[model samples]
Target: MSAPRMITVWGRANSVNVMKVLWLLDELAIPFERIEAGGEFGRTRDPDYAAMNPNATVPTLVMPHGYTLWESHAILRYLCRTQPGGNAFYPEAPEARADVERWMDWTLASLNDPMRIIFWALVRTPEAERDMAAVAKARDAAARLWSIVDAQLEGRPYLAGECSIADMAMGGFLHRWFSLPVERPELPNLAAWYARLKTRLPYATRVAVPLS
Candidate 1:
């Protein structure tokens, strides 16, 4: 009999999408191998890496059986379906699962672009090279979007009423949004939620790293 192949994740550690997957794996205690790719590591454009992820994106997941999956959110859903102790975060019930999924989708659709703009402007660009106008625009956009999240989190400890993939999806940006050297509106609930996420070891270690 052949030895089993371990699941592999290809992405750089600083990627928020990659961090989400890693945090969940740790939360579920699933062991997997990680290979550095994307960003400064720069394997993403290579033909071999492109074959695995045609988008040449960070976080291409290769399952133990040799199945390949791309897109971070899809990988998160697949892991929740296949791994033990996953249903707790991604629930089996249709409506309940949708609730969790809604925020994940929302994070990608509404929150991602503005946050990316803000991060690249403030973190990646040097102070002299910074585009303060663009940064201010993105900052305002992010604040408006985050206000919706703040309202949703008013009576809930986590999005979707429990610590789900929704939180994991948005968690990394929470770290960045708060950590960035920019003024922010007082969203008390969002602040509190961020504090809650900080208490989790997996979140702190995986998602809350210094912005690169």
Candidate 2:
């Protein structure tokens, strides 16, 4: 029998969190229906969506066995395991895989703060309503963070040098960092890496869409 299919993802398309899952699904070549939720749509807090996901967050995954999954990164990891060739996205080794996981974790743990403010100011919030102060702070902080990534890409093609999940996970946020309205100093290495990631199908179809 074929693998069961009852997968549905709930989230708005413009969300970075939602984009991560979409890009992963695209890379895995899994077909899924996405219903609009969260952000401006505001269905995330409804009892129906809440019942499936208590956190009321976008990008909830309804599995074939009727299991519900929440949190964006968790969904990425789950899909990486469930799909065929999943190990390609998230490997099953000790050294290289772990290193990839580290950068993916860093995107959520560290990059989120900086990316959020920058994203909101440039994409979500209108020009007059934007908080220039917060945007500036986030831009500076994110640039500092990018400097670390710049150093990491000294001779690598991708993070961990193989286009693993770390690149996609972090790529979603870095899209905004490069596109947002801010003065960024010339960091050729980071810029070049971002350019290379743009060539991926997932990055082009999902992550590289107009922010917001």
Question: What C-alpha lDDT, on a 0 to 100 scale, does residue 175 get in candidate 2?
Answer: 82
Would you list the clashing residue pairs of candidate 1? none
Off by over 4 Å in 2: 1-5
Which ten contiguous residues of candidate 1 have the minimum total lDDT?
Answer: 1-10
What lDDT tens digits, residue by residue, belong to model 2 across residues 40-156?
799888877888888877788888778888988788888888888778888788898789889988998898998888887787787899889998888889889999999999999
Query: Please, what are the lDDT tens digits per residue for candidate 1 over residues 35-89?
Result: 9999899999998888888898989999877789898999999999999999989
Best by TM-score: 1
> What lDDT is obtained when candidate 1 is compared to the true structure?
0.92
* Cα lDDT for residue 123, candidate 2: 78
Candidate 2 clashing pairs?
A: none
Backbone clash count for every predicted candidate, in the order shown: 0, 0
